[model samples]
Target: MSTKQKRFIPADGLAGLKQNFTKDALSGFLVFLLAMPLSLGIAKASGFPMIFGLVTAIVGGVVVSFIMGSRLSIKGPAAGLIVIASGSVIAMGDGEIGWHLALGVVVVASLLQILFGVFKLGKLADFFPSAAIHGMLAAIGIIIMTKQLHLVLGINPSELKGKEPLELLGMLPSSIMHENAHLAEIGLACLLIMILMSFVKHEKIKKIPAPLIVLAVAIPLGFALHIKTDGEIAGFALVKIGSISEAFKNGLINVDFSGITTHTGIFIQYVILYSLIGSLESLLTAKAVDGMDPFKRKTDYDKDLIGVGIGNTICGILGGLPMISEVARSSANIGYGARTRWANFFHGLFLLIAVLVGVQFIEMIPNVALAAMLIFVGFRLAHPKQILHTLYIGREQLIVFLVTILITISTDLLMGVGSGILLELIINLVNGASLKNTFKTNITLVEEGENYTLNVKDDLVFSNLLGFKKKFQAIPQGKYITINVSEANIVDHSSIVTMNGLVEEYKDGGGKVLVLGFENHRQLSKDPTSTRILKLS
Candidate 1:
C-alpha cells in the first residue's frame, strides 16, 4: 500500500474502529435522520408496506456495514429501485400477499447478484448507454412525481395501478378542485421547505435534516388538528408500522416459491429486473461514492456487490426491500466524516432505536409530508434542467434520452430499456459504425522516451469503456500521458466523465495528462463536465 493509503486506515481492520468511532457515530446519527424519512418515502413510492424500507435499512446498515468493501457507503432502499419493486407488486396483482411474493423474487435476484459478483461481472453496468440509463431513471422520477403529486395535493387518483404517467400527470388539475385544503397546505409547506433548504447559506443550518425538519412541524400539527382520534388518522393515510416482533414473526426466512411456479413468466421477469437493475445501480453508486471520498480510496466493486447481494438476500427473506449501496446516504456519510463501516452499523442501530422507541412519533408524521418529500425528489430526478442538459449534448444523445423516457413512461421498464438499447445500436449503425468495429475498438498506443500518446478512433461510449479503462490503467504509474481523441467520431458522457477522473488522478500522482483534438467537435453543454463530443456530418 502507498504511504497515503496507510495514512487513512490504522494498523488493521478493527483497530481503525477506535480512531474513527466518535466521528463515525456522529455521522451515523445524521445519516439516520436523513435515511429514516427517505426509507419511508421510497417504500411508500415502491408500493410496499413502508416498514419494509426500515427493515432493509437495518439489515443494510448492520449486516452489509460489517462486510461492505467500501468504507463510506451506507446501504439502504434506493429511490432507483422504486420502479422495479412497485412494478413487481403491480405485476403480481397488488395486494399484501403480492408484496410478500415480490420479496420472494428479491431473494432469487439477490442470489443471482452474488453469482454475478463472484464471476466479476460488475463491469456489465458499462454495457448500457449512459444517456439511456439517465433517461430511464428520469422516467422513473416522473412516474414517482406523478404518483405522489396527488398525495401532496390530497387527492388519490381513483386507481393507481397500470396507469400511464401522462394520465397520472393529467390528474394534477383535478386536485385543485377536490384537494383537502388543510393537508394540501401542509404538503405545500413541506415541499417549499425542501426546496428552500437546498439554498440555505449557513453550513450549520444546512446540516439540519430537511425531512426531519418537515416531520418536526408536520407531526406536531397533526395532533393540533386532532387528526388522530383513535389509532387511525381520519381523512389522511398514516405511516403504518406493525410491531417489531411482528416483523420477525412473518414467517421470516420462508420465501414462498409458489409465485415462481404459478407465475413462472412474471417471476422470471422480476428476477431479471431486480438483479440487473439492483446490481447496476449498486455498482455505479459505489463507484460514485469512491469518487466522493476525501481519503481517495477506491472501492472493490466486485466485493461490494457481493456484500450487498448477501445482505439483500437476508433482507429479502426477512420481508424487506432489496438493499443497495444507497448513493445519497453514502454521500452524506462521507460529508459528515465517516471513516469506517461502524458508521453504517451505527446508522442501523439508530434506525432500530427509532423503531423501538419512537414508533408512535413516526406514525404521527403525516403521509402528505412524506409524499411531498418524494415529489421533490422525483422533480429533482426528472427536472426540466436535466432534459435541457440532455438536449444540449447532441441530436443523437437527445434522441436516445427522449426515446428512453417516452418509452419507459408509455410501456414498462424492461421494454423501455430494451427499446433504448436497440435504438442506440441503430443510431450507431446509421452513423457509420461498422458491425465488426462496433464490437471491436480501434485504439493504438505509441510510446517515446519521456511520454506516451494514445490514439483513439470510432465509438468511445459506455459499451467499450471497460476495455478502454483497463488499457488506460495498465499504463505505468508516474508517466506523462497524452490522449488524442481528435480522430474519434464519437465519444459519450460516461467515457469522457470517467476519463476526466483518471486525468485528475494522473495529475495528483505527479504526472501530467493532456487530452487533445477537440477544437471542432462541439461541446454538448455549457457545463464543464458536459464534454461529450461528437462529429457532425
Candidate 2:
C-alpha cells in the first residue's frame, strides 16, 4: 500500500454496511467458531482458567474493534502470550490469588504499551534481527509443546516439576509410555484429524477451521465411548473443563485493586515482560495483517498498539488474558470477506452467545481435545519448514537463530533475546561495519511530477534503515522511484536486500526503480542485489 493511503479504513456508512453486512456477519461467525477452541486451548495452555481466555476474546473484539486502527485484524488471547501469562501466575504462587495478582501486571503493562504507541515507537521491534525473532518464537513453540503435550496424552506431568523446558521435556517419554490410552486416543485422533485436514486443498473444506472439526469428531466420540469425565487413568483422565456455572461468578469485572500493592515485585516484572512482548507481537501481527488485507490497506501500527493497550487494560480488570492483534484470526478474517471492524465485534458477540447458551455443551467437551489443538499450534510455531527457512537466509543467520533458541530455552525470554541481539552486534562489528554507520541514517527525498528520488548520505544498515522503508513505502504506485544511493559511501547486506526487495515489488506494480550506487559492490552469496558497499573497499 502507498504511504499516502495508510490511514485506518473506517467502517462503511449505513447504506454501505447494509450491502456488506451479510458478508461481514458470515465472516465473523466463521472466525467465531475458529476462535472458540483456540481461546479455550490457549487459556488452558497459559495456566489460566479457561474462562479468562473467553473474556480476552470478548474484550478484544468488543472493545478493541471500536478503537483499533486495523479494519480486519482480530484481537484475543494468543499462543504468543501463553508463556508470559502463565509465568506471571507461577511466579506469584500459581493459585487463585496469583491469577488476581497477574491482573495488576496486565494493567501496568498495557499502560506501557500505550506509551510505546504514543511515542511512535512501533518500529522498535524492527531492530531485532529476523533470525533472533524467529529463534525466540520457535523456542516459545517448543516450550508450549512440552507443557501442552502432557494434556494431549491426558497425563499430568505436574508431579515431575522442573525449572527449564528441557528438564520437563526429559520426562516426556515416561509421560507418554504410561499415558492414559483412552484420552490419548482422543487427543491423538484430534491431532491427526487436524494434520490430515490441512491437505484438503479444496477451498470450501479448507474454510472449515481444523479446531472446530476436532471437536466435531471428539465430542461425539467421547459420548459414544462413555468416557469418564473425571478419573486418573495412568495419571491422566478425560479432564473436566472446570465449572462453567462459576464463569464470571466472582464478577464480570474482577480486578483486585490492591494487587498492585500486594504483589508489587511480580507485578513490576510482568509489566516489563508483557509490555515488551505484547507490543512487539501486536505491532508485528498488525503489520503482517495489513499485507494480507485483500483491499491492500496499510494498518497504522502505532494506533493499533494504543488500541490494544486500551483493550488489554479493560481485559485486565475483567480477569481476562492480555490481548494482541492475532495473525491467524486476522488472516481468516480477510479470507472470509470481513469488510470492517464490525466483523471483529460480531466474532466477540458470537463467542459470548456460545458461552451463554452452550456453556453446558462446551463443558461436556473433554480437555484432551483442547490440548490437541494447542499441540498443533505449537508445531506451527516451530515447524521444521520455518526453521529451514531461517537457515536458508544465511548460515550466519542460522547461527544467530539457534543461539537465540538455545539461550531462550535455557534462560528466560528477555535474557535469551538480549543475548541474541548482543551476539548479532558483535558479528556485525567483526564484519567491519562501523558503529556510526550502524546507528545513523541520513536520507533526503525529492519529488518531481510523478517521479520521486530518495538519497542516502550515510551508511545504510538495519539499525537505522527502518526509517528508509517508511519513506520508501510512501511513494505512490506507478510513479518513478529513483533510490539514489550514489552518495552513500557504505551500505550493508540488510539495507541492500531491503532496497532490492522494494525494487522488485515496485517494478511488479508498474513503477520504476533506479538503485544508483551498487554497481561496484561485492555480492553477498547468491542474491546479486544483496551486496556490501563499505568505504574500506
Candidate 3:
C-alpha cells in the first residue's frame, strides 16, 4: 500500500491473520489459562454462577473481536461491571428469572452504547480531564486491591457475593481480629506471590507475565499436595469452584421483556447505568491500548463502542456476563506477540475448548493459585510508587485519587467514579485560568521592527496555553517574536510538547522564533534539545 493509503488502511488484517496464526493460538491458550480463574472469581464476586464468567469470556473474545475496531483490545466480563451486575441480579431472584431479567436490561442498555457510537459520542472521553481519569483509575485500583485481598487469602464473607468496600471494610477488622486460619494462610500465600512479582524486574522476566508464574506454582502445589495449617485443616479446603455442570445446565438465558412492561422506570435507570459504565470503561481502555501500540496507531473509539455494544447484546442473549475491553487481557495479548484480531478469536476458541473438553481437569485447579494470581494483579494496580507519583504531581489529584479509592472500596464503583469526577471538576474550577486574561490577552499583530516580546506571567498551564500560542501564531509573517516564560511558574507537559512542535513548524515556515527564560523546566527535560532551540529545561 502507498504511504497515504497505508495510513488509512487497517493493519494487514488478512496477512496479520495468516502470519500470527501460531502466535495467536499460543496467546489464546495463555489467555485462557489466565482468564478461566478470573472468570469464575469475577462471577462469584458479582453474586452469580461461576459459569457465567466463562461464558462471557468465551463469547466476548470470539464474538466481540470482529465487531471491535481496536486491534489489541480483548473484551470480557470486567471487574468494573461486578458491582452493577451483582445489584441488578439481586434486584431482579433465583433461577432464570432474575439473571435473565438482568440480561434483558443489559441488552436494552447496550443499545444506548450503539446509539452513542453512531453519533460519535465516544469523543466525550475527551471532555474528561486526564488528572480525573488517572484519579478514577487509581481509585479503582485501590478498591480492587482491598476487596480482593480477602479472596486472595481464602476468606469468604457470608455476606452477599459482591458487597462494596465500605461494608467489607467494616467486616474486615472483625475478620482479622477473630483471625480465620484459612484467611490467614491464604493472605500469607497472596503476600508471597506479590513479593515474587515485585522481584521480577528484568526485561525477559517481566515479559513472562508475573501472574501466570504465580498460578503455575501455586495451583500445582495446592492441588497435588495440600498444605496443612496450625489448625490441621488444609488451606485448600476454603478454595471453591463447585462444578462445571453449574454452567452447562442452563447454558443460555434471556431476559423477560414482560417484567419491564410493569416497572419500566427502574428498569430504564438500571439500563442506562449499565450502558454508561460499559461505554466509559471501553473508551478509557481503548485509549490505553492505543498508547501501548508500538506503531502509534489509533483505534476508532466510536467504532469500538459500537462493537462493544453489539458484543454485550450477544453476550446477554447467550447467558454471558457483561463485557468490556479489559486492560489486563489486552495488555497480555500485546505482550504475547499477538498481531491481529485472530488472536482474540483464538483466545475465545481456547476458552470454549477448555470448558468443553478440559472442564473435568480444569476443575482440579485450586482457587488459591488463582487467588495468588489475582493478588499479584491487585498489587500492580495499587502500587505505592504510583500513588506517591500522583501525590507529587498535584495534591488535588492525589486527593481525588484517594477519595475515589476510598469510596470505591467503601461503597461501589458508581459512587466511587462519581466522587472522583466531582472532585476533579472542583479541582479544575478552583485552578481554572482567569477568564478576563484568557479572553483579552491576545496580540493584535506584530508591528514593523517590533521585538515582539510575549510576556507570560504566573503558571502557564494547559487551560491558557491556546491563548499563549495564539498570540505568537498571530505574529506578522516577516516580524520576530521572542516568547518569554521567565515569570512563569509552571508549564504542563502537553503545553511543552506543543511548544516543541510549534517551534519546529514556525522555523520551517521561515519565521524566526526565540524561546527564553526557561532553564530548568521539568517538561523540557523529556524532549531533546534541537539545534534551533536556545532555551533549556
Best by TM-score: 1
Judged by whole-model lDDT over C-alpha atoms, candidate 1 comes out at 0.81
Q: Report every candidate's CA lDDT.
A: 0.81, 0.78, 0.65
Q: Name model 1 segments beyond 4 Å from true.
A: 1-12, 156-162, 230-236, 446-453, 509-511, 517-537
lDDT of 1 by residue, 103-157 (tens): 8899999999999989988868878887788888888888888888888876653
Q: Can you give the lDDT of residue 102 in candidate 3?
A: 80
TM-score of each: 0.91, 0.90, 0.74
Pitting candidate 1 against candidate 3, the one with the higher TM-score is 1
Question: Model 3, which residues run further than 4 Å from truth?
Answer: 1-11, 91-98, 157-164, 177-187, 224-251, 257-269, 432-537
Clashing pairs in 1: none
Q: How much is the lDDT of residue 207 in candidate 1?
A: 78
Residue 332 displacement in candidate 2 (angstroms): 1.6
Ranked candidates (lDDT, high to low) = 1, 2, 3
In model 2, which regions exceed 4 Å deviation?
A: 1-16, 160-163, 233-245, 257-265, 444-452, 470-479, 486-512, 527-537
Measured on C-alpha atoms, candidate 2 has an lDDT of 0.78
